[model samples]
Target: MRVQKIWGADIYRDGGSYGFCFDSDDGQWYEFFLKTRAFEPVSPESHQPPIIYRNGCNSGEVVLRLSWEEAQAFVAPLRYENRRFMELIDIVMTSGGTARRH
Candidate 1:
């Protein structure tokens, strides 16, 4: 089945790369990866362009590249939730409360 939604808390970002988990229509979970690069202009009159690369995990840890638009669709929903969660964590920590593992 196709992926239906993504979980906000499962996303990880490191520099120009990102990874996230999603739930499919069949109720299965999977992870995806995205990496971006800024390419310099080829000539003095040109402007820099951004390149985004997307990938999905296959069986046995293999990752296959996907289109940028497809990857963005999967990740878009989680953006706000992810930021909100982090803000909540920050509030808790700053208020002298320690975050504990469940």
Candidate 2:
């Protein structure tokens, strides 16, 4: 597949689905499920849920490709609120109550 880089990991995308390959880590790649907001690792002979159809069909082939921006657009909306909330929590934790309203 067409390799894309995001957050130091090689990313593969087919529509909203994503697979992240980190060479520094183990021999498995992480597949992100949009519906559940969860991830599963895909190994050589042990792929859970059998990966995705497009992914399984196009394995190692660059047939289906989406730009990084398109991928981000599909993913950003999924976690935008959570990311903002996490930012708020970070401020609360690091700002020593300075960022809190009285």
Cα-based TM-score, every candidate: 0.38, 0.22
Q: After superposing candidate 1 on the true structure, give the runs of residues whose Cα lies further than 4 Å from its correct spot.
A: 9-14, 36-64, 73-80, 84-102
- In model 1, what are the clashing residue pairs, if there are any? none
Candidate 1 lDDT by residue in tens digits, 1-102: 365675643322432333455577766666554332223334331111212222343343533444434434433444335653343233223331222332
| Residue-level lDDT for 52 in candidate 2 | 19
Q: What are the Cα lDDT values of the candidates?
A: 0.38, 0.28
- At residue 86, candidate 1 shows an lDDT of 46
Tell me the tens digit of each residue's lDDT in model 2 across 1-102.
Answer: 222322221113432222332121333333321111124353321111212123333354332243333444333433222332333222223321211221
How much is the lDDT of residue 9 in candidate 1? 37
Off by over 4 Å in 2: 1-53, 56-58, 61-63, 79-102
Worst 10 residues of 2 by lDDT: 44-53
